[model samples]
Target chain A: MERTPITVSALNAYLKAKFDADRQLGDILLKAEVSNFKRNSSGHLYFSLKDENSQVSAVMFAGPAASLKFRPKDGDRVLVEGSVAIYVPYGQYQVYVRKMTDVGTGDLWLEYERLKQKLEAEGLFRPERKRPLPGFPKAVGVVTSPTGAAVRDVINIIGRRWPLARIIVYPTSVQGTEAKDSIVRAIAKANADARVDVLIVGRGGGSIEDLWPFNEEAVAYAIRDSKLPVVSAVGHETDFTIADFVADLRAPTPSGAAELVVPDRRALLDQLDVLARKLDYVLAKTLSAARDRLSSVASSYVFRTPERLLEKASVRLAHLDERLDLVRPDRLLADRKANLGHAETRLSSRFMAILAAAGYAYGRCAGRLELVNPLSIMTRGYAVIRKDGRIVRSVDELVQDDHLDVRLSDGSADCRVLAVRKGE
Target chain B: MAQEQELKFEEALKRLETLVRELEQGDLPLETAVAKYNEGLALAKRCHDLLKQAEEVVVKIADGETLQDFPKQRE
Candidate 1:
């Protein structure tokens, strides 16, 4: 040992050599929770690996950090494979991480992937399995921790969007050992209540272990069994759970679930206002159209000039009058009257001539008959006489008691025959 | 009324939209149009009343079989 004053640099270099010489220090493995994790712009990762009793500063260069499977976040449990080295400049021993992995996570990741594949094969996450959300939810059932910020966000958002729905908070332990059963029970209760039309099952952001209940098989089955449609809002936006897959709707956050559960009252009112205005507009158009029809009828020629109704009849009558003028019924009647007068005169003259001829002929016949009639000469001083039934032509044949009949033109007389003469 | 309560908000909105469309079509007779307009006015009133009367939301916490009122907590 040189008993001279050695600079701090030389002391640090000596310690660096010692640490490099040890084979155990060259390659080592450690399990600790990541804290104060940071990635600068240059891509180097700086973090502290802490445990229950102690903490160690660690650094992974840009090369290893770029090849990392996951982005190292704060509070993450990681398995680090690196070499211990004393940085001479700082005179401190730190881990120069080469390969790092999440601790106690590989098994859980394999299980998640395996279950995801199995459930996907069973069509649980199929698009058809998703139910359509109601346009308006009468009651919204929230299945989460009652005291958590998630439930508060949901309540506040729902109150803003739609306060009409009765929000039934089915208080459930969203995390920890009994979270799986509590969530299932809450879902079942909400369904049994039959008051809620939709359900939002979720919690605020948390670590993977805190969000594990949503990935459980029991929670998935509960969502599937629920009659009311379930909206899964689990953890942060990046977190995906089995409940998200099995739910009818998957919202990125609890606030998003509240938004999806009900319609905006203001928007609904706007729509209603539009419809009311449309109703009035249409009714007005209908009324106007009716008025137009009435006015059209009123302004029609038939209505404007009522006398036109008889114009056709009057024209028809005029045409009939013209036809009657062509026919000349009065002229025809006058001609018939003249014909009647001529016929009457001719008929009377013919009848009178016939009567005159008969009278003349009868007179001639009567004169001839008078010349042959012996009693007709009585009027010319001629007489027709018979004595008793014989003429006294001879005195010898006469009897003094013979009766005689004398005939005259006007009358006949009976005389007793005192004497009878033959042919006297 | 219980029956009126059964009318869903969405269904009521849909019926109102339909009434508006029918009234707008202008093909209905005067009598039917007037009746439909009256019905539309009634529906509008119902919807308006629902909006104006902002009843406090019923926030209840489920505990086993029974439900109890949840305190109104503000963020």
Candidate 2:
């Protein structure tokens, strides 16, 4: 029989209604791998759930997605619990995923691995970047549920190990939807205060789901960015969270963190005792060494026999005195007297030669004088007359009556002049 | 003595260690060594006293509402 042709929209609407009405399709569980996962701006997650041979489209609305402990991503093997429905506009059948979980190891574990790989690639888990816990922390800040056993364990352990440190608890929720935000805020508050030298962020042992907040990225970043060194001590020794990898130090338990952050008082006291003893021994050794040096100097030859220096000085002075005697004034004077006597003898000889020369000259002068003498002329029969004690050699000097004296060789005679005569 | 309380355990320990090393080196004059020995003794006593007399841990709740002592459940 011939029937009326229906449009694509009408057929899709009918199939959607039929699927909604079926009880088997209303609540179904499918084990599949997530593929092409995309979270839209409206917070709705859209993906395709696929088996080895088949595939089905899936979508988780914003409300259920908000409650998810882990974010679903492509290639994740998950068990989705939801209803099967058809989109009327697209004419496609898809699963409306209400709850999704990891099939083999739980989706939270897979998510944990995924985040660990991502943060590790970003160098958040580098060993070189990890800081050492303070050896003597004055204050320790704990981020955990204040009412939980973890805080008490930390407080007591720190108290017993090192009672000097002060504990400041940043009370936070350790589980549920609000756990991540609460943990992040507590870390921030501790950092902002800047009073604590080291921080311990952790919770007591619980299921992976209960401990999921510690695995959150916000908490990891908070631990990474904290100025104070952070010690991560979450769950049992076997449970490792992302915060553990990003922290400055990882403790197997809350008590372990406490032990790592502070030094043991008893151990320190014992060490001080050892050092004190060492100081005593060293001081004694140093003093003895100084005394040894001083004694060695004091027993030297110079100090032992100071008179030897003075004796050597006296010998040098005697040698100098002998040298001075060679230049004595008495010896010098005797030499000068001998030289003067030799000079006196030479002077006497020179005086005798000069006297001989003077005698010969006087003899020659006397012979010449005799030749010019009037007495010698008298011997030749010549006479000189003097009138009025003058010699008259010219007849013009005779006067008619003048008294004259005739000078002879031996004597002078007095005569009277009677007449004047002219002679040719 | 109260000022010694303000001294950090690590700082005190470091100074004590240095003093021990200086004494061990053995180059100081006798008088200087004696003085250093006395000072070292004082530091050691201070360190020992501080460690022995440490106060118990003080716990405070950080809820951002009111800062109060966290009551201990047991000693």
Candidate 3:
């Protein structure tokens, strides 16, 4: 058959139409390694999808490319969904990618690991940097989707565990294009409120694509910089995100985060019960011990019968009194009187003896005087004559016809001397 | 006393523990022990009452712009 000549544009247009009409080509899924990946200034992505032995040109426009969870790099293994079509103007066939995903090791996972390593190196994920959850949180802030089961699960669980804590839900988009910004904003808002003691950033279990927002750098940094302690519960237990690494604490599930944030009221009450019993026991023991001590002291000899302490003194005082009676003034005076009377009697007898001796001496002297007495001569009719009160022994002492006083043994007379005479 | 009244449940519990410990140590004078016992009893009662009288859980929703109380789910 003779071929009709066709222009290059027409030929290309025919090939483009053929590619578009084929159902399989319209929606092709291919797993290939990315090569020469370049994001243009217009936000369009240009790359080549290659296998070991084959390669195909691929381009993702700005619309779908804007929604990519990670920046596609050269040599990244990717699973792309797009339609194969010929560009008539370029005269080439290429895949116009609608959606792209990492195949074996997911692109989001790789991004998560890269961020985890980076933040870990920066000590964001250091155990020392991890803040301890408040033992008694006054309020719990949750950053999660408002419509999902995550918030409900968290609320219910927290209610069951510790109802004292007020739940402040910061509603956020958990998935899709705005999920990252929503999550970051929610975390910021929760931190700014300053009312919540701890923050729970979480969502229900989802695929890596659905959970990509939590792996975002912005969300990770938000968690790291949050003033409130953050608890990350992004997905299933096996799913780890960068936010989990950067957060102060990580729980496997949203319910787990709730459980971790607050303590069970019943358990605390039980602990309190134990403590109350201990308090009672301690107080009772102290009281009884104090009472026993008091009683023991009260029953001691010094306190029980205080008068016994004075009993010895009283006996001593009585003995002292009896001894004092022996030195009484009346008894002393009576003894002194007896002694004086005896002395007086002795003195009187001595005086009487002395008087008798004196009387005898006087009588002896009288007798002797009688033996040679002139007064006795007077008694025998001889009288003593005295002129001028002296005996007239000398006649010269008298004068005749002179007046004289005369003293005799019995009488005295006054006379005048008449003449003087010598006596022999 | 105002501070005691403002004591958090955890703080109250901690104080009660310390009081019990002091009582158990057993050297305080009778008057001081009695006073401590009273304080401990008060703290215990406070903790108990706080736990027992806790209000139910409350949920609030951020309605894309402002936070409001989440509607209670119908049983």
Candidate 4:
């Protein structure tokens, strides 16, 4: 192998071509810690990926760097996925990083997935088991670090959105070795207090290590066993945890949970106020109508001459008392409701016909109500008895000592048969 | 008919017109005048809530974009 040696530029060029042609060298995945991270004004990322024994420089252009879920700072453990390339100008080799993610979170994600499947298998995350949140929550309990942005956002939103609801902060450490137990305890306390209408469990966005408590199995069970409806608001929009699965509702963020928990009162105030006015209008109409009837009745000579009115009433009562022997009051009432329903159908159909012609009116409601008013039927002191579904017209309809419903204009009475006279 | 019963805009406005005329004339019987005045006051209060009667529901977020409402779904 005796020969002239090749030039440095020629050798590097050849090495670069070899690196590009080789498939294994083209595609490589290195799990290493980031070091010497730097960024120039051009938006290209410069860093070294190092493990215990070896190190390699890497560059992620602005486009790919912007897509990274986690920032690659110094000492950040990352799994850099890209191709290996020879820098022919520098006569050195480096990785061209396409994607980079924090290694710690990757493992946490795997753990999260495993626990989610396990809990889901036990039906803890069943949709049917999730309780419906109260439409009007008087108090909302939040289990989060009281000092974090999450609690502040929830409180602020709830206050502005629905001031009627009281925000009760069940403060807890959201991360670290003790965070899992702290969250579990805080949830328990909220349930035990039993004052809050609903519970919100979450924390602000953070790294996986900071969000690990929410992914804990204990937190999932705590949420599952909650008495009040649990709303899970974990990290950013993309993060998912075991607690989210077990919660009745999973909000993308803490502020979103607040919006969902209680409706904005600005919208509801109008509805309630409208109903209140209608209530007043309906009541006033009833009063004025009653006054009109009273004045008209007062002017009648029959009321002035009391004996005349009494005599007429007694005679009518005698006739009705005679009819009372044949029928029960309950059957009569049911028949009246049935007739009213039929009338309502007929009147409503006519109402629809008039409405189709764009003709609408009021004042007929009182007359329609009068048709169903049992008081009008009993006005003359008439008392009738009904048996089964028919008016009792004969003593044959009765039995000895039978209890009968004696109906009157005022009300019905349960009358026991003292005696029965046949053809009397 | 139930829907018609809830359409109180026409009734409220007509009543208000009659009430203003009656009040303006100042000849209504004392009790009638008092009752009419109260009814007028209630109708005025209802007007405040309406801003104007709107058939469709519109969600007004404090500082958000205009969002339309979906039709109610019944089970």
Per-candidate iRMSD: 2.3, 2.3, 3.2, 13.0
Candidates 1 onward: DockQ, in order? 0.53, 0.46, 0.41, 0.02
Q: lDDT by residue for model 1 over A1-424, one digit each (tens)?
A: 7698999999999999999999999999998999999888998999999999999899999998877755578888899999999999999899999998877565767777888898888788989888898776778999999999999899888888787877899999988889999999889889888778899999999877789899898888889889999999999897888899999999999999999988888887898898888888888888889999999999999889989978999999999998887579897788788999989999999999999999999999988997888666787776556665654444565477756576778887886657656666
DockQ sort, best first: 1, 2, 3, 4
Give the per-residue lDDT digits (tens) of candidate 2, residues B11-58: 877888887888787777777789888988988998887887766877
| Candidate 4 clashes between residue pairs 3 or more apart in a chain or in different chains | A324-A385, A326-A392, A327-A385, A327-A386, A327-A387, A327-A392, A328-A386, A328-A387, A378-A409
Model 1 off-target regions past 4 Å? A1-33, A38-71, A79-100, A317-424, B1-8
Clash pairs, candidate 2, are A102-A107
**Model 2 regions lying over 4 Å from their true place:** A1-105, A301-424, B1-8, B28-35
lDDT scores in order: 0.85, 0.86, 0.84, 0.77
Between candidates 3 and 4, the DockQ winner: 3
Tell me the TM-score of each prediction against the true structure. 0.66, 0.56, 0.61, 0.47
> Can you give the lDDT of residue A92 in candidate 2?
88
lDDT tens digits, residues A204-276, model 3?
Answer: 9876778888888888888888989999998889777888888898999999999999999999889888888
lDDT of 1 by residue, B14-51 (tens): 78888888777668999999899989988887887776
Candidate 2: what lDDT?
Answer: 0.86
Model 1, position A400, has a per-residue lDDT of: 74
* Chain B TM-scores of the candidates: 0.74, 0.77, 0.77, 0.54
Q: Mind giving the per-residue lDDT tens digits that candidate 2 earns over A1-424?
A: 9999999988998898999999999999999999999999999999999989999999999999988755566777888899999988898889999999866557567788899999999999999989987778878899998888899899888888788778899999999989999989988988887668899999998767778899999888988888989999999897888999999999999989988988888888789989998987887678777778889988987678888768888899898888787577987677678778778877777878788888898899899899898789898888888888877889898878789988788887888888888886
